[model samples]
Target chain A: QQQVRQSPQSLTVWEGETTILNCSYEDSTFDYFPWYRQFPGKSPALLIAISLVSNKKEDGRFTIFFNKREKKLSLHITDSQPGDSATYFCAASVIMGYKLTFGTGTSLLVDP
Target chain B: EAGVTQSPRYAVLQEGQAVSFWCDPISGHDTLYWYQQPRDQGPQLLVYFRDEAVIDNSQLPSDRFSAVRPKGTNSTLKIQSAKQGDTATYLCASSSLGGLNYAEQFFGPGTRLTVL
Candidate 1:
């Protein structure tokens, strides 16, 4: 069974617009949620993260809105740019372990 | 500080062959992890260690896969007999194990393995 699920296998957004990527999980034990970005032929890099205690986290143009009650979360990118075009993965993990359950990923294409 | 480093960025092997992937984590990082990512799929945890002690490896394919982190700095993942289904990208990540809030994990470029 997939523990984490992401919607919209791919997405295209215009430059300067906002892009949203959604994710849902089946595990209630998940307390730590993180978003990662990956380019072609590269490893996934940490973009942002949030704990269950917080409903939202923002870092500059990136924001993660988490709804722990629904076991869902979404990553919002404001003023999207070409540099934001990449595959995005949402992951959930328990507090006790380093293991992460990842979503299938969303490929974002920001047109300039 | 330098990030996690992995050797042999790419590898091609025939079915039934054997291969090994190596990784050297950032200096002073005590937690290391190995993950397997198939095409269009998310990374799956294969094994992890905390300073030479295995923390979890329940997802590892014990029949043909094995991993070890010796000296708590470097790690090696080996496949006894490669198979076509074994093709995937192997990633290594590291984090400080000290009592800090979950540190952001740093990842290596990863090793792409293609088994024919």
Candidate 2:
């Protein structure tokens, strides 16, 4: 069974617009949620993360809105720029757990 | 500080052949992980070690896959026999043992393996 899932396998947005990526998980024990961004032929890098205690986490133009009740979360990228084009992965894990259960990923493209 | 480094960025093998991938984590990082990512899919944990101890390897295919972090810094993942289904990119990641950012993991460029 897939513990984590992401919607809209691919998305495109105009520069200066906001792009929203959705994610959902089936494991309630998961408390730590992180998002990773990967460029072609490169490794995935951590972009932002949030704990269950917080409903939202914002870093610059990237924001993560989390809903524990629904087991869903969304990443919002404001002022989207062409440089932000990459594949975003949503991952979840239990506190202190060493392994992460990752979603398939959402490929984002920002057209200037 | 330098990031994680992987060797033999690319490898190609025929069925029944064996291959090994190596990883060197950042200095002082006590935890190391190995993950396999098939094309168009997310990375899947294969094994992990904390200071030379295997923490979890339930996802690993023991029949052919083996990994070890002998010195708690460098890790090696070996496959006894290759198969077409084993084609994927193997990634190495590392993190500190204790800190406010312990959950954060830094990854290497990864080794792309193609098995025919």
Instruction: List where candidate 2 sits over 4 angstroms from the true fold.
Output: none
User: What lDDT is reached at residue A27 by model 2?
Assistant: 87
Cα lDDT tens digits, model 1, A18-110, are 999999999889888889999988899999999988999999999999988888999999999999999999998896337788899999999
Task: Identify the candidate with maximal TM-score.
Answer: 2
List the lowest-lDDT window of 10 residues for candidate 1 chain A: A93-102
Off by over 4 Å in 1: B97-99
Best by lDDT: 2
- How displaced is residue A28 in candidate 1, in Å? 0.8
Clashing pairs in 1: none
Error of 2 at B113 (Å): 0.4
The TM-scores of all predictions, comma-separated, are 0.97, 0.98
Per-residue lDDT over B1-116 for candidate 1, one digit per residue giving the tens place of the 0 to 100 score: 79999988999999999999999999998889999999998899899898999999999999999999878999999998999999999999998847866667789999999999
